[model samples]
Target: MHIIKYLRSLQIRPNFVKKISLIQARHLQTDVFETTKVKYKYPPVYDPYGPRPPPSEKVTQLADQIMALTAEERAQIGSALREVLKHPKLEKISTEGLDLSGPAAGDAAQAEEKKEEKTAFDVKLEKFDAAAKIKVIKEVRALTNLGLKEAKDLVEKAPAILKQGVTKEEAAVIIEKIKAAGGTAAME
Candidate 1:
């Protein structure tokens, strides 16, 4: 009837239009119509919800403070932050070869070893008579400019040189220190 005419005006399909109109008519009631009435009103354009949590009060304050700083101040603050974040662990080093013990014991042992070596050399030199030894020492001192102790050392070594039949020139060369030191020898 009127529903078909309205459906035709709207250009709806005939079968669907007839079914929808019949359903609407069956469900329609005066009280139900009153209860389902919707008064149209504009929804709010701007939400009243508070700001997001990421840009919280503390973060906003910090950002504002950072933005307000001069270049030098900002650099100083950045350097300070880097220093705070850069904590390094200290390593414990083992000093096995460092030998923290005092040198007294080592010095004593070295001194004793030197004394033993000197005693051995003295025993070997005992084979030569005092006059031969003195004569050898004077010759060595005349040529080498060596002190008494060094001259004695040369004398102690003379037996070996004599065994090899070292020439006067060779002996003179060996005792060059005595000549430099202004010593004289009757033999030379």
Candidate 2:
């Protein structure tokens, strides 16, 4: 009989009132504490339980000394450090691998191989003195083996090749002969 009366008393106290009390407790727990002080310090990443490495005393002293330097001194030191980092020690590079190898090696060699072997040179008549134009024309005509009209046209053109593809020695000889003929010719 006493247990039945206690159960009846609990039912009358109400379920809604219990729910409100639980919500109020949760709200108080999540409430922001505006009066609490903020800190900037961070915890070290190293193991706190193990032995710590000795602090760098020299580094700290050096840092303090650096801090004591004037702005100009610091700037100079900074520029020096920058130069050291940015520019490495100069060393001689192989000149052979640079520009001197010419068209006889590597990519240039492949290109040369693809090209027909240079047996004869193409003589480019660049310019000739007006006084020696007729002489230059006759020289071009003799070198080219073209007909009279064709030779005349080629000479009138002013810029014409006297030969096709030749060796270096032959090309040099041709250029020298053309120079001797009072015409500016290049062996290509």
Q: List the residue pairs that clash in candidate 1.
A: 143-175, 143-178, 143-179, 144-175, 144-176, 144-177, 144-178, 145-177, 145-178
Global local distance difference test of model 1: 0.57
Best by TM-score: 2
Off by over 4 Å in 1: 1-128, 157-188
- What's the true lDDT of residue 64 in model 2? 95
Query: Tens digits of per-residue lDDT for model 2 on 42-95?
Result: 667656678767769998898999999999999888668868789664577777
lDDT of 1 by residue, 75-175 (tens): 88866876789856446899986748766865987756655322111111113455455665665555457798976775665433311234555544544
Residue 36 lDDT in candidate 2: 70
Q: Write down the TM-score for model 1.
A: 0.18
TM-score of each: 0.18, 0.36
Candidate 1's displacement at residue 27, Å, is 99
For model 2, what is the C-alpha lDDT against the true structure? 0.73
